[model samples]
Target chain A: MRKIGKQEIEDMAVGAALLGTGGGGDPYIGKLMALQAIEEYGEVTLLEVDEVPDDALVVPSSMMGAPTVMLEKAPSGEEAISAFKQLEEYLGKKIFGTFPIEAGGVNSMLPFALAARLGLPVIDVDGMGRAFPELQMVTFYLDGISATPAIIADEKGNTALLSTIDNVWTERIARAATIQMGGSVMNAMYSMNGKNLKDSGITNILKLEEEIGKSIRLAKENNVNPIEKVLKTVGGFELFKGKVSDINRKTETGFARGVATFEGLYENKGETLQLRFQNEHLIAQTENRLLCVTPDLIAVLDAETGLPITTEGIRYGARCVVIGIPCHPKWRTEKGIATVGPKYFGYEVDYVPVEDLAKKGVTL
Target chain B: MRKIGKQEIEDMAVGAALLGTGGGGDPYIGKLMALQAIEEYGEVTLLEVDEVPDDALVVPSSMMGAPTVMLEKAPSGEEAISAFKQLEEYLGKKIFGTFPIEAGGVNSMLPFALAARLGLPVIDVDGMGRAFPELQMVTFYLDGISATPAIIADEKGNTALLSTIDNVWTERIARAATIQMGGSVMNAMYSMNGKNLKDSGITNILKLEEEIGKSIRLAKENNVNPIEKVLKTVGGFELFKGKVSDINRKTETGFARGVATFEGLYENKGETLQLRFQNEHLIAQTENRLLCVTPDLIAVLDAETGLPITTEGIRYGARCVVIGIPCHPKWRTEKGIATVGPKYFGYEVDYVPVEDLAKKGVTL
Candidate 1:
């Protein structure tokens, strides 16, 4: 796993920001916060999920709310760690480690900040390995875990404990709270013992993020398409390259939900692709056929810069490239599909690997 | 605390269905499944939150999904217990008791079914004490608990664990999977030790639900407005009595989000009110003024029958009474307001207690 230093964090943020596309929220504030943390606490140590002891207490830290609000509002950086400590006390156990919830935007660095301050190791893995809109969307959820007794702490040292019936209620309540807290709140959730992690957790997602980030940096240095490099690293497929022709967006329930239509480029010329986003891309379609849906990663990037464009950043006339990556193999199982497939997103589309879709010459 | 029998389950479901206000989804399937489990397992024992040891492991059981689909596709009944067992093994600890995530419909009885079979006591307290749409919208959340390592078990014996960055992701991933699992999945989440329960949980919510249910029954028999009785029990303020004039809804991200407009009656005549819902009534507004929002309890009932209305069941022409109950005083604190008030739900309005709103001389 890559051991990220203060220097690497800036590069990683640049890369993470690129992957965030426009909607993962601004990585600048989070980047600054994490860098400050690293400077104060020294470089963060990254460990694989399995490296955790059977009894280790692992917690994830993140910022919740609209990306737009985060840009305008600076975080106090005390909430996540405070929430973590509160939960640790609630469980009557000491926390051993911390980790990111995803590999996108501000969240990608939240764990880093917590781990640094707590003097604990941060896992290279993330629950999602990517970003998703809701609280329950993670590989950990697929592993049958709860995100309860979650501590949501605002910048003002005010903290609340949310124990819900399910993960979604936590989201519903937390989302509202985050908005009220001025569109952002640092949260510590999904606390689990190491025994549970050994069986259910995905290992080394932070390493993956670093790898993806470094590869993009390398691609830029070599003057190559960072998209191609990412696809190769993740074994993803190039779905389509195009210029954004139309964009539609609206903030619902404090989240950016919208659609983008792409006018195909290069070999994909004359074909059109429509993509939908809710924090992260939910679906990609070419005319009548739905191409890739949730569980699988549908990412849109600037053709020139190879930076990811989030729904919040999507604008008319932006030239972009749409790429589809295969989700974790586990997500392809019948159980996995039921948990995160396009059908889960209200699309009637059946599950199909992005690579297979590419091989079929069905452009999306 | 009430030791509920199968008969009480039915009445609770009926009452919960009303409180759901056309949105909690039909609790019919969840009810039937819980009934079958209870019949097979026998009667469940009840325990107050304070009765347990501080270290006791308490797990919550419920169904997560679109309530609309719940009516069409029923649960298999095997999942809740299965999920509970999986969590137990993962934690390497036996659960001391079971509890409902909320005290409405099937979720109210889910813990009882499991409790009977597992030979454990069912906690009389629930997270919300009422029904809410998302997984994390619970008093426990306000108390600073996390809902990670949540076990989501499908009917087909497939169970997944999710530990998200936050409760919101937990909901997003779990809901997506629930939809893929054919619309409904039995979930046991927000497992916590008793110490956390006492610190912030809404203790005795199940008992309160039972009392409310029984009081409603007694009130009906006594020719009293059961709605008024409920209001008195919770010390809530009557907001308005009206007939639903318009309902606007759309299914987005698998949730039914919409608004219902009401034409006031009696002293509220000529004044109009609108109730917003997303699995639960989130806000009530009268043009420029806001009446109530989450963390506080908003219940809609049949004016004539004094029955609650589910979020999905809101319909035009239905005569209803909208009542606003103050949430636990804890929710009104700055921390609490940051966690559950209207501002959290994306409104710019300040939080005003239902009692205070009533004292303002607003017509109801």
Candidate 2:
């Protein structure tokens, strides 16, 4: 186990934002929350998945709701603790450790904030190697892990401990509740033992996020293009470099649902790319080619700073590079594809690996 | 304590439906559920609020959703038991008894159905002497009793145990969840000790309902006008005797909302009356006069049989008698009026007691 200090949190937030693929909340807000918690409670211990005993219970710390709502009303930290406490009380077991449910700006950093305050270790593994919009889009769900007895607590001191028949039901009910509870709520769900985590979870996600963040930071000092360094670190293929043209977004049914259009720049002029999202980027396509789809990672990096821009942060004139990376092998399975693939998101497209799509150059 | 058999269940269902003020669920369905449970599990014990120990835990059994939805998707009985079991587990105490949260056909009978299955006593009391649409429109809320830690369970075996800052939040969150959980779910909420029930609840509500039911049934045998007998039994006034001219209703936002128009017959032949409702009837008025408004009870009964007709049961050209009864004295208080008054239901009128309105004849 290694201790995670402020520097680790800062780097992790940048990396997590990239992997978040334009969802999982804003990195600036997430970074501030983690930095503040670490400042007050000191460094938190980061434990590898194997460090936890097989029988010890572990829960992921995260939030559910439209990221737009979370921007205006950040969690007060108490909601996360309240959720954990309620889950423990209901399960009749003390949580051994906490971890990120997904790699997002807020989700990835939240574990550290909670662990620092509670004096618990932050597990290195995450259910998703990259972020997905819905709660059931996790490898744990693919492996049949139940997301209930899950607790969701609002900043207003309201909480609901849900026990659902399946993880999908958990997402449906919890999403509805999250809307009513001021459009955002902290969640302590997907509680499981270490064996399930080691077997199903994407291990060393935090390490990868830190490395991605470091690569971007070092590229600036070395006077090189940060986007190239970021793409190399994440093993991602550059889809398009473009300037934002037209973006339309609206918060509806507890989701930031909209599409962003980009005018191709530099190497790929005279082309238009469309990125559609429901909380996270679900599809990225150019005029005659399917660049990437869900179960694949699609991130937008600032043309200058190489910092990841969330869906909410994409502006009318911003210049950016879009990239796609292959998802974890778990998400490539038939069950995972059925659970979160393009068809599940209403895209009518068949499942194709990002690597395959990248190699083929263009497939409509 | 007394034993509640199938006969009592039948009578109470009729009475409870009337008290539901055209909102609570259909009596036929509620009666069938209670009678079937009684048939299998034997008689349920009925206890006066005073009979319960001061510190013993008691939760009310009810359902929250549009009655229209409950009609299409009847609960499987397992949902109610699941809700109670979850609540008991969360509280870490055996529930000493169960009661109705409101005086509605389904709300009143659900307690008996649950009590029979669990062999628990049914408390002879309820939060609302008459039904209101929203969860917080109960005396328990006025008296500062919270509705959480509450449990809501669906027929598909999903449950959510909610804890909120107040009853209103509980309603908001649970209502949203109920919509997602197939539009209806059984609820175990407003848990309190015996003392609190005695202090805040409307006592002898079941006894009153049974007496009203018996009066209606006896009227047929006595060859009497059942409306007169029913009015005398409940200390209610005849607001209008009319044939239904028009009726409109649609279930929206988890509530059956509509307006029923009546063309007066006999002594009131020249006048037309409009009754508006959200779950329960909230207002009854003529163009020239206000007859009754919530929290006073407004019930529509068959003019010939004196059996109550729910808002959903009202049909064009059906002859009916609209009656108004004074609410419990507790609901006349300032807080009670604010909680379930005419103004609360969006009617721009002051609350006048049904007795006063009847004595004055017409005040527009």
| Top candidate when judged by TM-score against the true structure | 2
In model 1, the runs with Cα more than 4 Å from the true position are: A18-22, A176-182, A362-364, B1-364
Q: List the residue pairs that clash in candidate 2.
A: B23-B279
User: Which RMSD does model 1 reach against the true structure?
Assistant: 10.9
lDDT of each: 0.73, 0.89
lDDT of 2 by residue, A209-228 (tens): 99888888889889899988
Docking outcome class, model 1: incorrect
Q: Name the top DockQ candidate.
A: 2
Error of 2 at B80 (Å): 1.3
Model 2 TM-score (B-chain only): 0.97
Query: What is the Cα-based lDDT of residue B207 in candidate 1?
Result: 53
**Ten contiguous residues minimizing lDDT sum, candidate 2 chain B:** B63-72
